[model samples]
Target: MTPDHEVLVIGAGFSGIGAALGLRRAGIDDFVILEERDDVGGSWYANTYPGVAVDISAFSYSFAAEPFASWSRVFPPGEELKAYADHCIDAYALRPHLRFNSRVKRASYSESAHVWTVVLGDGTALTARFVICATGWLTKPKTPAIAGLDTFKGDLVHTAQWDRSLDLDGKRVGVIGTGASAVQIVPEIAERTERLHVYQRTPTWLLPKPDFAVPESVRRLFRRVPATQRTIRLLTDVVTELSFVIAMVHYRRFPFLAKAGEAASKLYLRRQVKGDRTLMRKLTPSYRVGCKRPSLSKGYWRTFTRDHVELVTEPIEEITPSGIRTADGEEQDLDVLILATGFHVLDNLPPFPMRGQGGRDLKEFWKTERFQTYEGTSIKGYPNLWFIVGPYSFTGGSWFGMIDYQVTHALRVIGEARRRRATEAVVRPEKHDRSFRRNLRRMRNTVFLDPSCRGTHSYYLDEHGDAPAVRPASTYEAAWRARHFDLDDYSYER
Candidate 1:
């Protein structure tokens, strides 16, 4: 039996778009991109809160193939990223193959037919010869289970699902979770809100964001000569890889890099807070740098110094009808409650039921055996299935670089399978295990294992105490391996 589509891509984000482009390059046309929302730009579409922008430099954050020439700032805002996504879709004519508002419920592999049956939320089932999961790491929003949260009468909003119509000009607002989203949102709303109460569980390491408007002349120059932009992109990529990526991945070899990062962060924070020891003590994180992902912002630190803005370090006990009650018995009244809580990283690896050969559930397998993937794309039993973002997949650089290399890896396997006229392609169990072991060994050298990171509650470390979210190798190594990995590692069957 033949499948309905040759490939079923599980998202329309940058990852899925990259996969689509990869498919086009490989001359494979029978594919469909299933996006859950009624639009493209996965995270960028969902997050539209105040001060939303890319933390990384725009030059490095975007795709290398389709360089964006008209960025307003060094760190472009969310809408610009969304526009770039739109540009890619239009340029590649990917809209025809995209199915919006199509949420996948589950996927099951068939041994006899060598195909996958992917069921939608409404029970619409579609069969595909291959399935590529590009449902990104930050898809599902994490909401805390605080007591009396449901009973709160005020307007409650999560940063991931911001209400654009709601007015916050003079409202008393309480924001929780000082993650990346909060770091951006708090500063934007602080001056506007009547009384902005920022509840902090733990402080984050912050670096000074070098954000500035890109001149029209520079944009024109970039447009006129693409080499200039490429040069900047290359420089940014190299600097980020050396300064941040190498420090995290090769922590054992260069522990001083992380130390220097911590020193720089502290110095920047001190300068921002202007020697306010009380505020500084409350804002400083106890964990090692890179234990939790650090953020970049010019205004996040100084937001706490405002007279109207209060940084509540007391643990939250429960939510009252009118306000939040802290453990210290202080009740802060507010008209708006914002959850800046981050996304579900490890728990929602797939965010849906997935069954492989012999009815092996993917989540169950990971829960029991720890999250394992061969080169962060293919699994041992899950034939013809690949993940653009999988365990140990992210290389701590730009999202586009991750998408590019992972797409290259997945498409290479799929392309070879097509060339061989094979119906199934699964990584050998031994090969998958070897990769997993390699990840485990390399992860020990990282800062995640340091004693200082013990109680930080970092999203990078999984339940198994492994930092599977980050690829232990550099981006260059990842790209090289994606292109040169042995094809024989995957067993292809007709």
Candidate 2:
């Protein structure tokens, strides 16, 4: 027999978990969390790559439902994050309503019934009044499409979908793309690999992480005095939020901050890499500081100091049978190849065939690269469907804060729906959506969206040369907006 629920949340990641918990808190327990994987922790479960850790601080990267006073490191590792998600599940008693190993294959809205008919991969059909697409942006792995890639004799892997069985000890390795994953993995591999060749499309601004372990005494003190930890977390969030003002307001006008960042990067380069000034120049980024995500790592810079590691900044023409070949007729052989190229972030929602009102597909409607919602949650045509960390909500600070805020907004919407006795509600107003996109385009002209950036093809920018993912200013502002979900912003139908 097919099961029925009031709300069905797809993918039991952080977002899905938040949605389920939020619904429960609002006295809506008839919702089920369907997870493709048997376990929770969406991205953290999939990515077990070496040196995989959160770039954001531990305090802000955690859930508001359950705060952790005993984080082992300043920047917690993947395992710790996964454990935290598990802890939330256990603490909230959310397992009873969760359906594991049930991947949603199709979701079609029935106009006659005013309900969503969702089909699982195993042919099980379920009905729900509302559907929450909590499948996160970074869950999918995007491997670069290179010629002769399949012909490679050695093992190939992506940082997101890492193969833990493969050994890198004493083996020649080739790493493609110097993005966030590359910055984290290269240092760990450099220690084990015989010869490591890093192919950089463009150099990124490497910032000092200042990552360190929290002492046992400090953890005990935090546990004893909760106010102290909260104060520290708030201070950190404020400082990080204020830093985005330069990128939002004076990107083009303010070259001083970018210059200072560059000068600092140069100093770090000089300190890390010796005996080769040309190599340092190649490693230096030509773009502004906030143009792309500035990577933070202690060992990323120090890894280049190793004798066996070589950083190659040549345009890759194609992949040969043995290894990768450059445009300048240079070819390098390797035993293993790792692609650290990021995910399909522009395509926030995948090709899952989502049909909104009037049989209009959401993907087709958003074809012009103007994927705007009222508050990054509800689309104009999509009724009763909410996106947790949707478009324009990509505040460069800690994502956890934003997720919490969105979850709260979603709960409020659900509460409103129940109170009004409405079957469904679409929280996007046409004017608000248009105005938000217009403001986003105007803001893109600033420093963060510099046209002359070394690598213009960033996750921050969409296909239409506009940065739709980044938030307007800071994390606090984002949280405030999310927490105060304006009913006026949404066009509700009872």
Candidate 3:
């Protein structure tokens, strides 16, 4: 039999687990969590590539309310991250309400009933009074276009869907893409692989990583005095949050900061890759540091200095059964091809079908009208449907930063709706949605809309080329706005 609930939370990653626990603390128990995976840790569980680790510092990248002072490194590894997710499940007693491997296929709202009918992959249907879509932007893997990909008589791996069983040791491996994943994977793989060919379309700024081990003594002290750990987090958070100002405001508002960043990055490149001017120039970015998300790595540049390693900046024309062919008529053979290509984030499309008012399909609705939302949480036509890390909410803040803001706001909305005996809580259609649309225009003036970003492959822009899929706000500002949000802007239908 289909189940019914007061609220249903989709996704089991950082946002989902955070949301579920937030509900429990709020005295809301009539909720369930549906996770597509059998386990928690959405990206952490799925991405088990050679050197998968968090790019953001572990000190500041954690949940603001829930701190783990025991992380081994400044940035935790993939396995450790998954372990942290497990800890949350246990700490919050979320296992009872957690439904694993229950992928939601579609969801629709009933205007008359004031409820949502959600379907699962296995054809089971359920109903809920409210829905929270926390399926994050980075869930879906994007496959790049290259001819003869299927014909290649070698193992192909997408970084997200990594095949743990397959071994690339002593193999001629060719890594495609130079994003965060490539920086991490290339260093690990190069040590073991016979030869490594890195295919780069455009190079990104590689900053020095300050990754280090957390001493046992520090952990012991943090365990004894929680306030000390919180202080560390506060300092780390302040430094990280300032990057938002540098990227969103200063880079465009003042050219000095941007020029200085470029100069420093060039000096760093020269310092890292000496005696190879061509390779150094190829690796150097022509764009600003945050034009595409700058990657931090201790060994990404040094890996290119290896005798057997080759950085191919030539345009790839097609793939052959035995090797990949470049547009310049050059060919490179490999035993394994790894795609460091990122997720399909800029599409702004839902993973499943979502229909709201008058049975209007969410995709069609977005297609026919402007993609609008109030404070990046609630939509006009979609009542009682909330999004975490949704459009304009990408503060480049810690995942916890966005998670905390949205979850806190959602709780307030839900608490008020239940207290007022309201069946539906929806954002006002015309005025509020229009205001956000105007704000989006202001974002176009930021660094993301710069000419350097225009041609680069980025997740920041949508298909229509709208810059900054996220709201260009600092973490502090986003949290403040969420805390001070007026429920009066939302309509409650009894």
Candidate 4:
């Protein structure tokens, strides 16, 4: 039973608490971390549903090593971002190097003891001369395979595994896939369901959450005004980088900002579903406003202007025993189906089990095509292995500024693996496979990789249409290229 550490960190969230506070400010206190779940708010402790907030903005989604300044709101739910990741694990004492429920399953990578063994899930093995996965990319939960979904039988849950003791008051729910956790659980189960339905397949581009609240004298003037909340998070990161350069280099002079965001989403869908024009053209979304990931809500359009909601864009075609069967043959009974269908962000490291170098297998190098790494945290053959918010590292803005720019390029690759007395480091396989195929062919010429754009298959591409998992820059140029860490793009191993 010999298990130690110098870094192991699997997933205490927020990129394993910024890779254990960047290896405890790089002094490297024999790390640990783990956390299958028992705390430390990873994915805000498995998403406790019901309008689980945070659409970025809590002083640019915190952590420059804790500067929340008491954010009451401006998009801050999920139990106040799981009490601000439990106040950054008690202001960085980090619970004696966490461990929580401990899961890990399988990690492997020895190449003659450069180390990383791992194991866990009751077998317990551990050993780490570096491993920092920070397992995120929306902590699992994808559900949806449909077809009698376990014989309907009612209560099915999924918005990232949320199931808070069931009971949606009058029940009758159903709510499947509208994305962004079904636009925050279909306006919070259309206010205690009794008839919700809400199916829909495509259609999202929401926007207009201008959220509020933060007063306690603006959280004591953003903690006694020191660069006043980093100059209002750098002027909301320069107006969200000039609105992603007006949706990628001035899309035809912003056709009146996409016709005023589609006439304010058709005037908030005719003030929330009055006379339901076929559920307002099935929540109209033919796509455009930044292609996808655009939801923000003032009660998700007044919970589809409830009268016990309805929405249903059809096309389910299964799940019988008493609900959800629409491929036109309609059915809809329900008692509670939920799903909200999201996570599995292009399979970013599902259930551990990596196995890099020669044995290859990062799920067969992402099914031999899509998932690349390079800047999304080094991969070529995964050496000391980092991956804070890995794989193209999604960023429309503020994923805590891309997990503090991948914890400052994984604390400068653990200070270049303690100045070259390194055990392993990799990431130089032809300069990380030609910088991940030149950033997936420069984001396949933008417009959300326009396959003639109409949108829907979320997780931003990877059934081999190849977008290689997000990050088309502009989050302050990916936190200024993850704050400078580029030993000529890696390759060490002494």
What local distance difference test score does each model get? 0.93, 0.78, 0.83, 0.75
State TM-scores per candidate. Answer: 0.99, 0.94, 0.97, 0.33
* Candidate 3 local Cα displacement, residue 492, angstroms: 0.4
Candidate 1: stretches off by over 4 Å? none
Candidate number with the higher TM-score (2 or 4):
2
TM-score order of candidates, top first: 1, 3, 2, 4
Q: How good is model 2 by TM-score?
A: 0.94
> Candidate 2: worst 10 consecutive residues by lDDT?
241-250
Highest TM-score model number: 1
Residue ranges of candidate 2 with Cα displaced over 4 Å:
1-3, 244-256, 441-445
For model 3, the superposed segments whose C-alpha errors exceed 4 Å read 1-3
Q: Write the per-residue lDDT of candidate 1 for residues 260-373, one digit (tens) a residue.
A: 999999999999999999999999999889999899998899988899999999999999999999999999999999999988989997889999999999999999999889
Which TM-score value belongs to model 1?
0.99
Rank ordering of all candidates by lDDT, starting from the highest: 1, 3, 2, 4
Model 3, span 456-485: residue lDDT tens: 887876656665366777778878988888
Writing each residue's lDDT as its tens digit, candidate 2 over 302-419 gives 7877889988888888888788999899998889999999888758573377787888777777775477766667787677788776676667777777777778777777778778
Candidate 3, 327: how far from true, in Å?
0.6
C-alpha-based local distance difference test score of model 2: 0.78
